[model samples]
Target chain A: MLGAFFTGSAIVERQRLGLAARATLLLLCSGLSLVDSLHQANGSLDVLGRLSVLVAIAILAVVAGAAWPQSVWVPVAEAASVAVLVMANAGPHQPLLPYLLAPALEAGLIAGVRGAVATAGAAAAMFLAASPFEIRKGQSLTYSSTASEWVLLALATGLLAAWARRLGVRTAGSNEAYPAAYRLMTQLRTVSRHLSGGLDALSLAHIVLQQLRDRTGFDRAAVFVPGPEGELVVLAGEGNVPDWDTSLASDGLMAEVWSQQRGAARQSGFSGTKGLVSMALPLTIGARTVGVVALERRFKWEMEDDIDSLTSILDEAALRIETALLFSEIRTIATAEERRRLAREIHDGIAQELAFLGYVLDDLAARSEQEDMQGELRDLRAQVTRVVGDLRLSIFELRSEVQGQTGLGAALSDYVRSIGAASAMTVHLVLDETPNRLPVEAEAELLRIAQESVTNARKHSGAQNLWVTCRINPPAARLTIEDDGTGLGTGRDDSYGIQIMRERADRLGATLSISTRPEGGTKVDVALQARPVEIASDQGAGRDQ
Target chain B: MTTVILVDDHELIRQGLRRAFERDADFEVVGEAGTATEALRLIGELQPGVAIVDIRLPDANGLDLVKRLRAGSEKMGIVVLTMYSGDEHLFGALEAGASAFVSKDAPAEDIVAAARHAAVSPRAFTASDLAEAMKRRLEPTGPRLSPREREVLAMLAQGLGVAAIAKQLFISESTTKTHISKIYEKLGATNRAQALMSALRLGLIRQDPSPDRP
Candidate 1:
């Protein structure tokens, strides 16, 4: 009985059961067994026999009560030992059969109906053998009655075993389901937290994919979401699936799953190996298939059974993706509108005031006879132009959206020209690249990196000449920004800009290096590999607007 | 004197502009209007030689007013003065029949010169600023050529044929032709000279330093 409790405690820990109830059951079983074992001793022992019996019981009690049992076999072994001890020590006339019931009942509860019935059968056989020993010791046996009693005992044990088995199955099923549910709940919580925290769509998608990969424990997982072209493009993936084509055409199993807007098992030929079964789960929100998650290593039957679990997680992820996209849209619109308002205000207010100042200076210049006064007025007018240029650039940047249709190269070129016009430095821009736009997220990051580097140079470096070069070579590209400034490390106390650039480069899977030129100045070099191929016939046809 | 109607919302700007014009013997401030309706009425009543309109009037866009004024009379000069410096604004103004487009930050002399030029030859008047922006907006590349394409066009303008450009750019001749074709496509040109001319006019390619560039 005590061993049953020990085994139960182990199972409870593994299954995340309540600790307090299991501990109480263990204590109650141990106390009842000790009292019962002593009562059945029937004064058959002299002091030495009594001492031996007490010692034996004490040892059994300690093993059953204190020993930690991890497996079902541990408790089974203990039950067998208890039955043997009971048969060997209990006197023939005493109520000896009751002692045998403990082990049998425990086996029933811990292991199932078959285990219980088998244990009872063995106990009954041992008891019958003891009856023969009793007959040899001149104790007459009522054979007919004893045979009926044995039948009754076996019948009772079988019924108890069946009852225990039903209860055990239920507990086991719940034990399996609880943790999966909890993990999914936690994942949902994280998604909401990230959304409220205003993480951008790319970062949010990346984090969610990582979490899904970890939680599902798949050998390989990749998230393929529809790009602006309604073509499935690999957004993020784990394991040995990186080198595969990033875009998916509308005729494969992946596209079929997307069109079907449901999950099913399909076979894929990955990396030349044929017939590898994979589960393609579409992430749909309100009848629209937003994306598909392809998972290798999940068997067909297993996925069919676990589809509910997978869908619950994928559903939440889809909602999050939708929310993130909406959040970014709202942010973009709000920012653009706000900037336009500010620009209009500045144009009406400060710009007009400065223009009036310029005219005033012009009037003073025409009237003044002093050459020095006219020169000062001219210098002041130049200052006003610089201020106006600065304002215009600000307005342009605030209105600039990386996801805008004009493409990143144009935006960067405009920016560089504005800088040249505003500052004393001679800025040269060389952008030779394909017209195909980078993914919106990548464009945004590249723009940020360029802006940071240019601002850093303009503010601190005192550079006379700045050269910004962007070259696109189909699936790869390079951006090199060099300045004839006081070399790389001269006066850059702010490491934040460099850190941000590194982070952006890392996110884009691009290599970035900043170093001092051997001849003069500083150079920033960034090399980007891989541009997602367009699979859809028409670009940007997916957006309803 | 070229009689000019100054239609700006800011009183200080109108006063300063009036003074700048009063100083110039070739120009006169015939009227001033703060709103589009007022400007239309003043133009109709005073019949100024030129009307300078600010784009962001409280009541109406200067482009719409320009169109309305142009529909009324082809002879009256319409000059747009605004803070917007993008090619889009310049194009919008030009499409609405404004003869000149100038940034608000331009020197007083530039505005006076634009007014004088517009008053005399309203049909032929295209301020250098407006003409440059218009050319950029009309480029086949649509004012957004990548720097490398610009470099390629500049080299082509200097009379480097495809093979010479390829060698200079460290690329193959086939690649050079591809770049040249793309440049031509962007410039809306059927041949090399047309692409070069458009690129030069758009300020996309550097003008050849030769005396014959114009």
Candidate 2:
């Protein structure tokens, strides 16, 4: 009807003008039909009238399609297509029909189950109103048949509505939770493992953000966390944060989601905002809330379903970040302990000797007379020997390869042989358990014990015979030293050197055992459990460092 | 002439002292032994007037050799030289029948002089020297406890598990436990070895009869 005015003004004037007017008329009619279908009326629509309605609907559809390129209508315009089909199926031939698929499809596409059901009811009523019971044309619409048709139509409609609604909900649910769902799949695929490996907070946070990005899509994603003042500041970001009065907007939209505590969004008329969108999650590691996360993305979509995925993703990511931070802190503490141990070793092994050397040199300088000078020279020579010993200990302490370079086996052998030559007693050493190398701490402890025992035997024990042995296994290593000597100053006075050895053994978590040799001698034993190669070596490196 | 056997692990110290001793007409080296075993064997063979021995020898320590010589040849006077002169060593050497426990730093002449004197009688060994040596051994040098204190300490040093010691003393376990606790307190010791070490240093324990269980 509206096309009559446009045609009078533009038909035959130009193809473009005529086409434009027709397009506008079709669009207007299609929209009008949709409104009619949606609104319920209880009055009389006769059979002829219903048939005309179908004709009009078909015309409206044709025109609407033609008008498509010229009109930037919303997706909601799809309802017009459903309405056109509904009328064509139930046209006034009064085919005595009671149901149609168009309404259900339209409902599934647009309003879903309830609306589709309602549309079916309306269509059924329209069918009854269009053609009343007339027996002459043999179209005798009995009350029972009419009631049955309405009943079947209602049931079919309700069922179709329900089915379409289920599909829509399932698809929507999967789509909205796609991020979390994907994240869950990934976590299942590659759950992390325990390690002594370490990392820093920033690096862990970086990993968290990276993982989260994989699970979701966002335009200008950013993480805002609480600052010192309790106001949220950007701790990390994925996208730009637009300055907007997003405070209450987020609170009102996202914080109110009931089931999951996830925020639901509407076409927010949140004024004074610049394309701002946000969702906040209470980040939890275990039961403690170290911080809260505020995420915002600038995009338009139904984001309500994403709530579940986002919350879970953020929560897991937060936990991992915390764990990584702890690992990093532990590494720092271990490094510090290593430094302290190194400091003590340096002081004890090298520094004290140098100081003693300094005193010896001073004494030498102060001496007078030929005989005194000769005696001083002897003292100087001993100090020099001590200085050399200190240097060896220092070098061994400083570098791992130094011991190997000097050849620990060779050094130990040479020490025993040399000491034997210097003293009356014979020193014998045996090394068994071949192939596998002992850990560095194991080696160091063994060396210290050997040195102390030798010194004590030479200085206190009038022992004539000495024997030392080393045994190694995968789990543990052992060293034993024995001497045929009077035991520890009549077996009563404490050996300070032995005490030091015991202290060191305790530090290594090794076992130390000593006993009087059955044949009037002394025997000292130290044993340590073997650890995994990597762990043992790494521990050695840690202590060495 | 005072005939003697020279026993030592260090040949230089032994030879050095020998040159000074042989110069005296009264002292003569009848035999030489490098270890406690050799010294004990030679003591059987030589029957010398005196035995000059280094306290710290290769084959055995000071007290062991002294005890061996005393047991086998009770009449032979013995003189011992050592780097260590703790009360435990002094009393231990004395208990082993060492006529005297001398220091390594002592002049060779002084050692020869002591050896020659020991051959005669205990009167030849200065009581003042013996007393001074014992005093040094019985007193604190560094952080070590006096000898007698170390003995009393050994009772405590046996450990918190000193149930037998407690039973022997007819004391309650708790009281026994308290004594052990006080021992730890005085020595700043946390365990058995520490207490034992403090007690040994203090010379509060008997160090003469036997050696420490290694």
Strongest candidate by lDDT: 1
Worst 10 residues of 1 chain A by lDDT: A536-545
Segments of candidate 2 deviating more than 4 angstroms: A1-545, B84-87, B122-133, B136-214
Q: How does chain A of every candidate compare to the true chain A by TM-score?
A: 0.49, 0.30
Name the best candidate (by DockQ): 1
Q: Candidate 1 at A176: error in angstroms?
A: 35
Evaluated on CA atoms against the true complex, candidate 1 attains a DockQ of 0.20
Query: Alpha carbon lDDT of residue B48, candidate 2?
Result: 90
Summarize candidate 1's per-residue lDDT along B1-214 as a digit string, tens digits. Answer: 7789999888998998998999988888989999999998999999999999988789999899999999998898888887765666777877898888777777888888888777877766475555444444454355556565666776776777777776676654544555666678778999988877887777776665544432
In the order shown, the candidates' Cα RMSDs to the true structure are: 16.7, 29.0
At residue A370, candidate 1 shows an lDDT of 97
- Indicate the residue-level lDDT of B143 in model 2: 36
Model 2: what is its DockQ? 0.01
Candidate 2, residue B160: the lDDT equals: 30
